[model samples]
Target: MKHIAKVVELVESKKDDYIALANDIWSLAEMRYAEFESAERHASAIEAAGFTVTRGVAGMPTAFMAQAGRGGPVIGFLGEYDALAGLNQESGATACRPAADAANGNGHGCGHHLLGTASHLAAVVARDYFAAHGIEATVRFYGCPAEEAAAGKTFMARAGLFDDLDVALCWHPSVANSVFMNATLANVQAYFRFHGKASHAALAPHLGRSALDAAELMNIGVNYLREHMPDQARVHFAYINSGGISTNVVPAHAETLYTIRARTSPEAIDLFERVKQIAEGAALMTGTRVEMVFDKACSNVLHNDTLDAVLDRNMHAIGGMNVTANEVAFATEIQKTINPDDLANASRHFAAALRDPRPIIPEILPYRPDVERPVTGSTDVGDVSWAAPTTQCLTACYAWGTGFHSWQMVSQGKLSLAHKGMLLAAKTLAATGIDLVGQPATLRAAREELHRKRGLKPYQCPIPGDVTPPPARAAGTPAARASQDVIA
Candidate 1:
């Protein structure tokens, strides 16, 4: 409780500094694995806050770590700075106008700029609290980049970065403040490249074996297998490479980047095995050999009730963001720009499920009960959760149901509403860190729950074989697989 008050005061005093950091990151809006400026900014801020900064851990140039305080219960806060593509827009208004110099490119459409800032603020506050109160604990800010597709967390987990953590706390920018208590599906990604002899369609059509056919058949196989899979399993695929220019030319090469997801890692592995068999069958039928490159993968979240309770306490302690008149007016104007059907469905859903009916504005979330809504997405955070005791919270930083990669979210990265949400998150995480340091029984109970959920099964990466990290073309290495987890 004392630590919560201390963190509130610290955050209030450093509000301008935190806002500048968040705004700077919002202005940069760099894409995954290339958030150079954003990473530097966060590292600089952490250094200024008196934390020892370690840069480029786990082979990621932008990935870094900042630590403060002596050891006790080591607490880690997750931060991301990656932006979305093709969403460059002014911070206010609905039009897709670009900021003067950087036009029509990447922007912080998912509010990760705020995410990093809040995490950093929480870390700074926790560090200050330890200094003032002599609470024995280590505060760490994980400078995670490329959350959009380049799963930096997976590599960090694999490299034993988080294995020493007693408890890990993370939060995301969303439509409301709530302690997330559901499970995300485990997922794997791969690129199936098919090769065949190239030939002119008019003259040597018989000599060419179309690689595109293999890609199409593989997709078909996956689509048909969906019916046979468990109800919980989710299969998604997209065509990233078609290997051709014209209809007259017989394409010799093609690629299908597929992602297989399931309720858990073991289940996902089984499903991926079947998918690999189907790919082989597709290749056999098409008379083309295929090269399968393992991309990136992560496990599903194993919900922890004990840690969820701690997060709930923090969520209550920090309180929620009540929208004001100006906030409401801006939200209404933004609502007018969206598709009417989307607005109607979202309003209907929120009204039925939440206390509010207004689209782009979700209701206040309480401490307990699993959110009835489905997460529908996966993250490498699941891997870390499996390895250690972890709890995640969601702060309403954007408009309700704004969805990911939308101009609506980009418009609110660090505006007052987003800042309020981030401040709440900082308080929640900093307080949670305090609680973990002060309460050993809570940590023990959280670990027990994690063990019960996992049972005897060990954690496994959904990416089978040796999936190399994708090479950052901007970084200038021949594009490896470091950030290849993104299938979309």
Candidate 2:
């Protein structure tokens, strides 16, 4: 506990530096696989703090790893800096307004700016603690990129980057603070491209097969599959390409990107195969050739109770964030822009946990060992969880009712309240890392829990062996244009 106090003090002392770094990242607002500047800043900061930095790991140019300490248990912390597309917003604004220069630019709507900074700060603190106390332990900080669209960690796991770690720690910015004990969905993403001959639609329609028709039919078939699949399974598609702009011209090429998610990896793979069959059927019906190009995939997270207990203990010891009245007023202003339905839903969801209605949550949520709420979303961290005894916690970095991937989140990303929450998370994570390193039994117990939960099956990369990471796209290119366009 004394060590934890010292770690907290160290983080507090360097608060301004971390805050400035977070704000700089928030301004960059780089997209997936294109976080060159954001990754460089973080790597430079960690390297300056005495951690050896390795850039471009796992075939991703933006991904990197920073490490300190040379001996005992190798404790790793995951950091993400990728921002969402089309969410550009002015900082600290209460109203819906785009960035002054770019109306539809990328933005850190997911609070990854704060997320990466907190984890990096935690790693820095852990590194310093090990040095000052002459303790033998390894501290690693992973600069994971493209978590928003691509499962970056899935590729990293396939490369065996996490094989030597004793335990992994992660945290996310959210509306509340609590350890994540729930399991996330396993998911697979792919682009289905169809090929056909183009012809004049009005003059010689029969001379050409419509690839756009194939895409439409494929979507219809997949939509019908909703009834046959498991209740928890989810299937979504986006029209990446609509063939051509002219209605009179029969389009020769078209593509649709699909994402399939389920409660487990096997289930998701099964559903993905069924979806592929539907695509084939659509191609047959339209007299077009279809090609399935795999993009990325990730496994479901294997939650470790031992690690969760450690995180929860540290969170309770650190206490809640100290939100000021001015910060509360700012949060109230941001809350006004949130949808009424979202506000109502959040209110009902946190009714038992919250004592009163407040825009900014200022309390640490109690950890529930029995709670197993299924997070419908997918994360690259799921793969890391499968590879190691990994666990993540969430801290309040946004207004209570603000939804993710929105202007409200981006607006509050650089505010003082967000900085406070980030520092709290850093302290909590550092404390947890220290505890794990001090007690090797705890790490063993976590590994045992992971093994028991995983059974006799070894960790398998969901993405096929032949499937490599997609190449990074040029700046200013739309995501659709960046995706692979396979024609059969």
Candidate 3:
């Protein structure tokens, strides 16, 4: 308890510094693997804080690791700092207003700005605790980028970055504060390209074999597969390229990005195979050739009750966030921007835990036992769980009804309420890391639980060996190209 209190006080003293860093990251608003400035800011801060920094790790320019102390019981903290595309909203505005520069601009709508900062702050506090107590435990901070579109941690996992970790801790900014007992879906993202001969539509219509036709037919075929797939399985697609705008000419090439998700990696692979078959049939019917370019994939998260209990204990010991009256007023205004139906749905969803309707959540929810609830969404953290025992918690950073990946979330990202929540999350994670370091028996129990659950099934990276991380969009590199000639 004394050590935990010291950690909490340390995080409290540095709250303003981290909040400023979060604001800086929010303003930069870099997306995906191109987060050079955002990553550098974090790396520089931790480097000055006494942690040795290693940059350009795992074949990623923005991916890096910072470490302190030495020896066994290595506890790692995962941080993300990628912004979503087209969510740029004016900061601190209650109304929907895009940034003046562009109608669709990038912003930290998913709260990764705070997400990355809180984790790093926790690692710093843990490192300070280790130095103060003369503890010989190792603490690491992972600067993971491109979590929005690309599975950065999945790529790092394949590179064996997390293999030496005894346990890992992470957190996300959300509407409620609680440990995640639910597991996220495993998914694969890819681009399906179709190529064919081009010809003048009005003059040589018969000579043209339209690739656009093949893309459309492929989408229809996959839609029909919905009924045959398991209820938990999901398939989605977006037309990345549809030949050209000239209707007078028959298109020669078209492409659609597809994402297939299922409860497990094997299930996702099975569904992906079925989708490929459908693409072949579409190409055969349209006289066009099809190519599958593998982008990336991530496995489902493996939950550990032993690790969850540690986080829950730390969270209770730290207590709830101290939100100010002005912060509450700001949150109340943000809540007004939400749709009536959304507010109603949120009320119904959290009715069991929340007794009264409020703009900001004022209490920490109890940790519920794992019921295997379906998360439906995907994250790169799932891959880290497979590499080492991992557990994550959520903090009340946004208004109760504020949906994620929206302008509303972007607006409140740097507010006082959000800062308070971020500080509390840092305390929670720092305390958890301290506990895991001091209690070697707890780490043993956690590792044994992870082993028992895994049994004979060992982890295999979901991404293929041939695939590499995508280059920045400005660099003009295609996400993935066919390894072999098109199957015809």
Query: What are the root-mean-square deviations of the candidates from the true structure over C-alphas?
Result: 3.2, 2.1, 2.2
Supply candidate 2's per-residue lDDT for 139: 97
Each prediction's TM-score versus the true structure: 0.92, 0.96, 0.95
Candidate 3, run of 10 with poorest lDDT = 475-484
Clashing pairs in 1: 360-400, 468-481, 469-481, 469-482, 470-480, 470-481, 470-482, 470-483, 471-480
Off by over 4 Å in 1: 340-352, 359-363, 370-373, 456-458, 474-479, 482-488
lDDT on C-alpha atoms for all candidate structures = 0.77, 0.86, 0.86
Over the stretch 1-488, how does candidate 2's per-residue lDDT look in tens digits? 67778988899999899999998898888888889999999999999999999999998899999999999999999999988887889898888788887523888999999999999999999988889999999999999998987888999999989988999999888888788755688998888989988999999999999999999999999989999998678999988889989999999999888999998899999999999899999999989999888888899888888998889998889889888889988888888888789876664343135646588877888777775464547888999988899988888888898887888999999988888889989999999999889988889989889889889467899998877776676544534333343444
lDDT of 1 by residue, 1-488 (tens): 65566777888898888888898888888877788888999998899879999998877888999998996889999899888877887788666576666633778887899888998998888888888887788889999877775577887877778878888888888776777655588887777778777889999899988889888888899889999997678888777679767888888888877778888777887888788888788778877878777777788877777988888877777666677887777777776777767654443322124644463443446554544545457877888898788888877776666666788888777578888888888888888888778899889888788878878455555554456556454532222543332221
lDDT of 3 by residue, 1-488 (tens): 66677987899899889999999999888888889999999999999999999998887899999999998689899999999887889988999888675423788999999999999999999988888888898999999988986899998999998988999999999887878666688998888899988999999989999999999999999999999987678999988899999999899999998999998888999999999999999999999999888888988888888999999988988888777888889889988889988876664433135667688886788887734353547888999998898988888999898887899999999888788789888999999989888888989898888888778466689988877887656322345442433555
Show how many residue pairs clash in every candidate, following the order shown: 9, 0, 0
> In model 3, where do residues sit more than 4 Å from their true spots?
101-104, 347-355, 370-374, 475-488
